[model samples]
Target: MFLKRITLLRENIPSMKKYPFYIPSIQNLEEIDINNKVTFFVGENGSGKSTLLEAIADKCGFNTAGGGRNNFYDVHAAESSLGNYIRLSWLPKVTNGFFLRAESFYHFASHIDTVGAAHAYGGRSLHEQSHGESFLSLFLNRFKGKAIYLLDEPEAALSPARQLTFLKIIHDLASEGDAQFIIATHSPILLGYPNADILSFDDGQISKIDYEMTDHYQITKYFLQQREKFLDELLNDE
Candidate 1:
């Protein structure tokens, strides 16, 4: 628990009508107290989960595009709009961390290759490996010791089994008390980590909710359990 809380600097904002700030959950956000080693941000698209995560990464001096403090490269429109308007309160600050943006991971891999830094990530080029394999390799090799990892939609490249594998990796890192993770994800499997804090960006606010209350969990459970009836209702025209 390096980062103890995230407080929105409402009084410093120049406009309420702007993007990011206008997003309902961010607009209403006062402060988010991070009490768990792993915190999961759960929300629908455009619900402001990723937005806040990106801001925190930016604030941490990690490239908002993706990568750690030293991994610098360019990608269009990669800056965080909300980063400047938020303050992160750290109990014992840590400078070592990584920010992973799923959509721009290819570019990050490219940056690694250009810098000849593949030795740190499993001693093989990320581009040479499958997407899921590269993700796992990065987790296994590079993640270590007193750091915060901010990941956005890591499930993009992972299969169900791979997600389970990722969860085990998370458990190993977190249980050691050496890493903190704040992940923005739509994966029920990832959200099911025992005793993790799940913050929902729904109903125009950010609030802690039980894992079972998430739409991801409820909907996935329903669809799997009642596929025929679920499809019947969906395909039916009222």
Candidate 2:
């Protein structure tokens, strides 16, 4: 229960909020509860899923770009101002955790090399491995239970098989180790994490929805079932 809930202070902004605020979904958001042990943020691009994850990471004392608090290599400060206005209720003590942004993982890996902490991640340089391999290595070697993890599109480099493996890692951490996860993703496979919270950020709002109701599931299901039919329509370029 280290990171319990989050609420937005819409009126507390001293000046105009920028990138995230400009996005319609985030603009109107007021509050979102993180009561569930595993919470997932699902939405289309620019729908505020990644933005919210970054803000949460910032508020939790992790790098807005990604990695744990100790890993700080702020290249350009590209994160938005949404973090300052976010209010989180937490338990007095939070177990150690990590914030992993797939996009900036390369930079974090470089920092690991600079600090000579490769042993903690996998006993080798992350750069030495392929993209997906590095990610799996990080989670497998690190990530003990009872910590809060924030991941933004972590499936970016993983294949379908790896996504399933990642999902198992998440489940093990939560069920076996008491770890909590907050993730933003587009993968239907990851979204099907056995009763995890699915918050949809579309149509200028964020609301909890059932697993089967998600567009990701429906569309993926439809496409898989009717790929040939869809190819007939999708490739019907007239």
Candidate 3:
């Protein structure tokens, strides 16, 4: 199962003119391949990474609730004008997958008992666990084989050490060919998966980039280089 291409067609989008509706246009759309076990989307805030993932999931008929066939009203509200293109495309469809939004897992966990139990080791809720432990548990226990998992900002709750743990889990998933992941994240560690395609969305377009060339990698390098100076400045300011 692979995603050959995804496209966006015209639809009514928000407008500030006389009418509140305007047609959204997507030209020279980005083409992403699921050839690799992991594909990452990296971009600044509001660059449409989440929108793209939702659109792809919508195109594939995955429930927005992150599980089996159960739709919510918000799913309708989340619909994109790009649905027209998704409707007309010939992408290999997906079934049995989870779209884990790191921020929303707290709410999501409340709904599933097994997930709740996993998060709550020995009757302790995920809240009782350190943020990193909770995140690792979610990644390790929830992701099974051969499913397309979509993750957004997974590193938000993880420390550098936990990020390494995530990398190991991802590597194991790939080796087993039981999972294909599309992750939108900022952690350099998560983006460091060998041979994974890194697509950068910037200035209204998406382009393939090398891992070493990523902003996350460069930013992390810069900080590590000037850690003492940064720490001094912060301490002095306080």
Candidate 4:
């Protein structure tokens, strides 16, 4: 793996009662070892998975707003709050990589159009494509070489079928040993990648979890198998 581990610098923090530090998982974080080329970060909203991912992106010199080294642009409130408090350990560090934040992708697309770099993303403006198409276009065309990719909630725009397509893309990139991916996602499909490491940010801690053990897997499975019963329980007031 390119990024071997991430160490949280608790000593550098000015206060543990602050914004990022107050988040349970991050508050308790010590260190995380990245043991696979494809590592998935799974957690509930506000659980600090994305916060930590953004920090890694910041440390990697990528635009925390969402982009690779050369794609620089400004987005308000895009700065990573926790970035300064973590250290990444890379084995034979790589400079080539991309950080994709779904929320700020529109701004990245606008910047690409302004810079006339649409050719790299399928020869058409990303804005012209549907949201899912645009995401896939970037994944299919711009990802290559020995690089690390940090993606936050990539499944937001993808349909279930498209999500399967993304799995193939990830497999192709990772199998060749030229690319490593650290993705924060809620998609149970993406979490099923063979031999990938799944980290759960739950119960105020970060720990490894099995695929079937994930709530995403169990819930999705149960819902599919017992949709009526599941909805009855969920919708029942009593």
Candidate 1 lDDT by residue in tens digits, 9-116: 999999989998999999999999999999999999999999999999999999999999999899999999999999999989999999989999999999999999
Overlapping backbone residue pairs in candidate 2 total 0
The digit string of per-residue lDDT tens for model 2 on 1-238 reads 5787789898886654566687877888888877788999998888989888888888888877778767767757647578888988887557478888888898888888898989988788999999999999999987896788999999999999999999999988999998889999999999999979899998889899899999999999989999999788889967
Q: Model 1: clashing residue pairs? A: none
Model 4 scores a TM of: 0.98
Candidate achieving higher TM-score, 1 or 3: 1
lDDT of 2: 0.86
lDDT of 3 by residue, 147-227 (tens): 777787889888888788889888888678567788999888989888899888765567788999988999789789999
- The candidates, ranked best first by lDDT, are 1, 4, 2, 3
**What count of clashes does model 3 give?**
3
Give stretches of model 3 more than 4 Å off.
11-30, 63-92, 114-128, 228-238
For each candidate, C-alpha RMSD in Å? Answer: 0.8, 1.5, 4.8, 0.8
Model 4: pairs clashing at backbone N, Cα or C within 3 Å: none
TM-score of every candidate: 0.98, 0.95, 0.76, 0.98
Q: Residue 130, candidate 1: how far off, in angstroms?
A: 0.9
How does residue 128 of candidate 3 score in lDDT?
60
Question: Model 4 off-target regions past 4 Å?
Answer: none
